[model samples]
Target: MQYAQLGRTGATVSRLVLGTMNFGPHTSEEDSFAIMDRALEQGVTFVDTANVYGGKDHRGRTEEIVGRWLARTGKRDEIVLATKVFGEMGPGKNDRGLSALNIRRAVDASLRRLQTDHIDLYQMHHVDRSAPWEEIWQAMDLLVAQGKISYVGSSNFAGWHIAQANETASRRGSLRLVSEQSLYNLLSRSIELEVLPAAEHYGLGVIPWSPLSGGKLGGRREDGVRRRAADRRHDPADLTEQLERWETFCEERDLTPGQAALAWLLHRPGVLGPIIGPRTMEQLDSAIEAVDIVLSEEDLAALDEIFPGPGGPAPEAYAW
Candidate 1:
């Protein structure tokens, strides 16, 4: 697999990151282990997980499963492990958020669950409006000094949130965020408005999650099929048309819809890689194939015509 520098950091990661959100709840431990083994075999060194994965009752279960795989194969040093915080992990209100106390407790809990001494990337699952940047950065700086986490990242943060957080870090002369993870896919291009530009300007790698739009772009759903039941909600006719065009585009190139979607993200500016959350070994193998499917300029233009983004970043997309 091709590798790229994660933002301005010295570390290089695989072009495709393996996501473990389905572990325990949707996939069994044996299958999760097999999928992870296949990922490493296919040269995927980046694996991402969150503390609140595996459903409410099974929170931290996915990390435990991953930890077992790491122990069984003794490949802890071979992978760049990433995990997130800022979810309700306990019965109390203090169990979540970016408060220094919660961060301290959460990191230790995540480390224990993952069976690792240090996390390669520790990401905030979402922005904590109540917690100031000072508290957040101070906790993160302590973690860095203690060798607990090498780099910091954010997930589901807006453009201004990234700017504010990084500006705080810059003023403190501490390590700034090296990456931003957001929901970006062929059907969902909202991040193209401001988030992508902010990440690019700040030298942060953009790791896109939900790159397939929850199986809508995975080629399993029939073209022109309504996403929701008519009784539940009205499906947009334009979305169905877009999906039809997307399917035709993929078929013309002899590529699966999922593969084309991933290739699209890989070619987008400021994108380090797209997170692929595969439940089975077959899905894992299919996602890895996207690394080799390069799209030409004409193909990219066709895709733009199918699912247009915000036109371009920010005011240029709107004004002068």
Candidate 2:
């Protein structure tokens, strides 16, 4: 577990961040605890979750499970905790977006649920178009001033949106987002065309989610099950062409699709870190092994030929 700076904020985080999307729904509390323990034991000091991952219909279940683990292990200080907001959490419209009111409300709820007073890296789950950039950045800045969160970031945002927010923060002289999280993988290299360059140019760290392209790279699809629908890969509509190209590339590289996929991103320059969402120790090990499976120039060329960048039609809005 190598460590890297969290953008320009001077905070260091583990190279591999443990994502807890399964903590609430498909995974049980005991399983969640075991996963967290194993990740920590393996030196993964960065954990990412969200207020919406808890139980079905009951938001914040994942945080509750993490809170219990923290209390039991007394390891809150040992990890760099990251979580997100902006998904629909309830019936009311107020439950969503980056509005100052909701940011305040959500942070308090997140703190209570996670059993922590301050978050390490707070993030906007997605770019909420309804709110102006200043309003959102100002609200996050307030949280920083109040000592509720150490740093701030964004997820599923376009390069332009992040630039706008950072410019807004500059004008206000507040803390701007230091990191940007988006989807990146062998099958989904679209970010390389814009988002990645923007992050590098602005000195913003890049932490991509689903580096495995859901389960497609993992090599364990059940019979009759869709390769992506079950695991939420790039929008099904946009994946056909990319997945086909990936399948061909895997054969030529003599790499399990997963290894090739992860290895490609592991070596991409300017990536602060890539979030690995493994459900078990085996899956986790495979992900870690990818860090060392260096790809040759030829291998990369093959991939570039398949998932060519912004020149092609854009992937769907829901691909994230």
Candidate 3:
């Protein structure tokens, strides 16, 4: 497991983050435990989860699973644990959003479920449009002062949101957001339009989730069958052609499409690796192996031709 500083922070984290989204809903508790054990054993030290990952009825199930694993393994000190807030965790209106009240309640609930005193990184699951930056930062600043969380991050935020956030944090003398978890992959390049650039400019590490675009790039089976199309809604001719070209390129290079997908993110600038949410040990190993599959400049260019981004970034990507 290669290590890099999480954004500009001195605290180092594994390049390949072990996302635990599948722990409660998709994977059984026993399997989840085994996979986590294997992850730490292999040096995948950064783990990410959320308060609403356990499906509708079991909102905090994933955290409880992770907490139990921590207690059993006694490896709390060895791992960098991150989780999020700002979701409809209950029927009450206050049960959601980034209000200071909710933030306070949410962190304590997450800490209890996680069975840990302090979270390595606490992220906003989504931007709360209603919550003022001062209110949000005030709550977060209090948490930091109390040693409830070490750092703050964001997910599913746009470029300007990142700018507005850190600019506010800077004024308040806060460490601000150190990372941004966005949906990024070979197939999903929209983030390049603005999100990626903002994170880079703000000195926030980009941790890409859904790095395989929900298994669209999970690689074809040995029998040459696609588990699912990249996008079923509008499978345009161009997208079909791109998929064909991508498959052929991977075949010629003796690489699984999944590996190509992950390796592509690893090659990207400002990327702090990607979130690999493996449901099984084999899946975990495959993702770990992808970390070593280095893509050359030519290979990257070919991939760009297949899944071309928003051209480049901002005005240049559009106007010029």
Candidate with best TM-score? 3
Q: Model 1, residue 22: displacement in angstroms?
A: 0.7
**Candidate 2, run of 10 with poorest lDDT:** 311-320
For every model shown, what is its TM-score relative to the native structure? 0.95, 0.88, 0.97
Shift in Å, residue 184, candidate 2: 1.7
lDDT of 2 by residue, 1-320 (tens): 67888898777888888898887687778988898898898788999999888666878888898989998999999999999999778888799889999999999999999999999999999988889987888899899999999988899988888889888888998768889999987667778766887787778889988877767665535484436546654566776666766776776667777767767776778787788876676777766666667788887777777766454323333353
Candidate 3 C-alpha error for residue 120, in Å:
0.5
Per-candidate local distance difference test: 0.91, 0.81, 0.92
The reply for model 3, stretches above 4 Å from the true place, is 229-238
lDDT score, candidate 3: 0.92
By summed lDDT, the worst window of 10 consecutive residues in model 1 runs over 226-235
Ranking by lDDT: 3, 1, 2
Expressed as tens digits, the lDDT of each residue in 1-320 for candidate 1 is 99999999999999999999989998999999999998998899999999999888979999999999998999999999999999999998899999999999999999999998999999999999999999999999999999999999999999999999999999999889999999998778999999999999999999999888777677644575534322212244546767777878888889998889999999999999999999888888889999999999999998888888889999799897
